[model samples]
Target: MSRHHDVVVIGGGQAGLAAGYHLRRLGLDFVILDARTTPGGAWQHTWGSLRLFSPAAYSSLPGRLMPPQEGQTYPDGAHVIEYLTEYEQRYGLPIVRPVAVDAVRRDGDRLRVESGSGEWRARAVISATGTWWRPFMPAVPGRAEFEGTQLHTVEYRRPADLAGQRVIVVGGGNSGAQIAADLAHETDLTWVTQRPPRFLADDIDGRALFDHATARRRALDEGRTDTGGVASLGDIVAVPPVREARDAGLLKAQPMFARMTATGVEWADGTTAEADTIVWCTGFRPALSHLAPLGLRGPRGHIPTAGTRALGEPRLHLLGYGDWTGPASATLIGVGRPARDAARAIAELLAEA
Candidate 1:
């Protein structure tokens, strides 16, 4: 059905849900368009062994805190999925499932969102489609010649898939480190990074990162500067398995190789390492293809925004894109402020018109 809404929140993940909460508070007529048949956003696609670096207390959305499971200090993907599903249901948020948005264009003063089923017109569109779909792979020479299995972090499901195989895990982020640790048990594994990864002290975790993020944002909002030495979540937190792997020396990663060889990869030092599989844990780009028809995006497919409100395109707002959209915006805890402020701004703008 082609219809109109006061606001349309896209993606229905943590960011979208947070926006929906604020929209509900303001009594706005909004619909959340989600691509997934189930809840949990990209968490469903992560490796089975993945765990949140933070405890449940530090990993919640806007309205509800994720209740820690009995005796479960850190929640797994399944637990997060369960909480997201419950959050959607608990708020009675209106979500259209599996309706992939193809394009967003302007019609008069409103924006039309085209999807497989139909189209939706909204006065304000909040693009919460995070950076999980567009996996990035660096251009390495001879990648095509490598006669081995290669998969991005998005396609990885579990460790058993590469059992007994020689696997090279690429990227130094949390995902790469965790996946490398898991695969080390099931295969002959090596880790590769562009530069050495920074790990926080063993006593720190997601809580400290969240606090640092808040402090930095507060400093910026007050027109001051946050000095360095604040720990970013980019630094690896010593999770249990990662700690074990570090102790076992499996967490060490060599510098990025120069090129891919016929069987595997070759380092700059002229040493060659052969592997049956290569898992690229490289990160993703923002999933903003649906807005291509609007022709408003600039660098890296993101539009300029003032506190989540799209600057040039006044009717649009983008949220939960790593630091650009909002401070630490990609995380579960960081999305709330932007979502709430965006929703309020949309309400005020719509009320004026």
Candidate 2:
């Protein structure tokens, strides 16, 4: 079966919900297609111990603020899910769930979004399918040969399950640091990184990071020299837990392993460590496989865009991927601007058409 609208948004997560808020204000005919059976998008999949980088007020969508959790400085993943769920209900966004879109192809003057449940043709399409679904595991020799268990961030829930076991946590980003900290006292933990991990000042939070990104974006837009933005500050924000772990000397990181071994991993310096499990917090690529039929992706498997609108195909908008789509666009607070901009651009184009 097929339905039609002025716009069809794929992925009903934070990005899609943000887009829906703006689209509703513009009185556009649109429907959001979410693959998950429930709301909260990728937040539903985050580890139990994961916490947002900012306070509730600082992390919010276009229309509503996330309510603060009592006695909690930084809200956990469940709180984010609750906020996202309430946000969707408050706005009454039109959403159809559990419909996994397989391909988005050109259909004459419109775009055809083909999914298992049905098909939707729209003048414009918004792809907000975020990166959590595509966790990245780097290519290290003999990774498959390791006899112990291996898992990525997506599969990790809590550290209690792996308690009393020797485990290695790999990656230099916030996830690596946080996960390592979560497991510090529970496991015989060995934190490994490609390089030394950079921790932001204890005082800095998501609000500061968002400000830095916005400033950097404004500078570049005004043709000023690019300030490194968040990168200049650091990679890992010393969140309360991460800060505690660092202060307790639980986050000391080792250099990357030379290769995987049957027992564990071996380093170039002939150092070796045995482990029962390895948790990879490496990161993820954008979840854009549904857009493959459009043939608009660059060599990096990313759709090049001017703001959130696709460069080659202006009818399509890619939101909440990362800095390439918009500065800090992946964050709850950061996604609003790009979503608004994309919605406005689409409105203008559809009006012209």
Candidate 3:
């Protein structure tokens, strides 16, 4: 028999789990469909060297705080995965694992979530799929002809794998900076960004950024005219490793190369440099191919969302993509608020039904 739920939350990552936490509190019959076999969501696939930009206390979901191990401060990817596993057990969120949602189509008054395992019919659906599946790399001229070891930040795992290689780390975001710092210890790495990278103040971390986001969101909501300057999370946080690299004179960044050569890259000034590997730290797009059939995506391939709720499709809500869906919804500390609001919106819809 086909299963049915009042609400179906796709992608059991931080965003989906946050929504599930709220839905459970609202007494709604909902299920979270996770593509991964385990409970950590995309964190399970993250590189071993990856750690949260903030401390454990600041990077938590709605209900439970991520408890760190003895003497541990900023949690690594493994710590997050363990916490997520424990969070699911603590709340007993109704989650089905290893279920890849293929497509969501309108089924009369409800939406049908068709996955590889089975089908779930629900009146409301929340897409909390973070952008792990959609790692993007820009098209460098003649990139296809370059015969080199090219990997994105998603495929990269160990720093030792890049040891002794002339690597070009692309993107000015936090990931690129961190990865460059990691590789610099054992290898020759050239940092490449479209523009110069901005390093955040030493005191500022994810917590402070989230606080800023909250204040700005509040000001926008209240129609206040005095809007203050906000910082992007992409700005490099002077973490211990990054600082160490900076002190060692490894934080030097290079301008983006004009094009790719068979051996390496060509500079805008007609300079040539050879590299063994290219680690593109370019960001991701929303994993919204499943929702493509609904004809809701705009020109940029994003659904127009009004605070987590789809603009035209009230029955649909998108969480944890970026600022458009909600304030800082893409961060660990950022996803909770939007997920909570989405739950409330879906609860109101369910009540009307």
Worst 10 residues of 1 by lDDT: 226-235
Model 2 C-alpha RMSD to native: 0.7
lDDT accuracy of residue 177 in candidate 3: 84
Instruction: Give the winner by TM-score.
Output: 2
User: Where does candidate 2 stray beyond 4 Å?
Assistant: none
Q: Predictions ranked by lDDT, top down?
A: 2, 3, 1
The digit string of per-residue lDDT tens for model 3 on 248-345 reads 99989999999999889999899888889999999999999999778898867789888898887899999999998988898877898888899999
Error of 1 at 290 (Å): 0.8
lDDT of 1: 0.87
- Please tell me which model should have the higher TM-score, number 1 or number 2: 2
Question: Where in model 1 is the C-alpha error above 4 Å?
Answer: 229-234
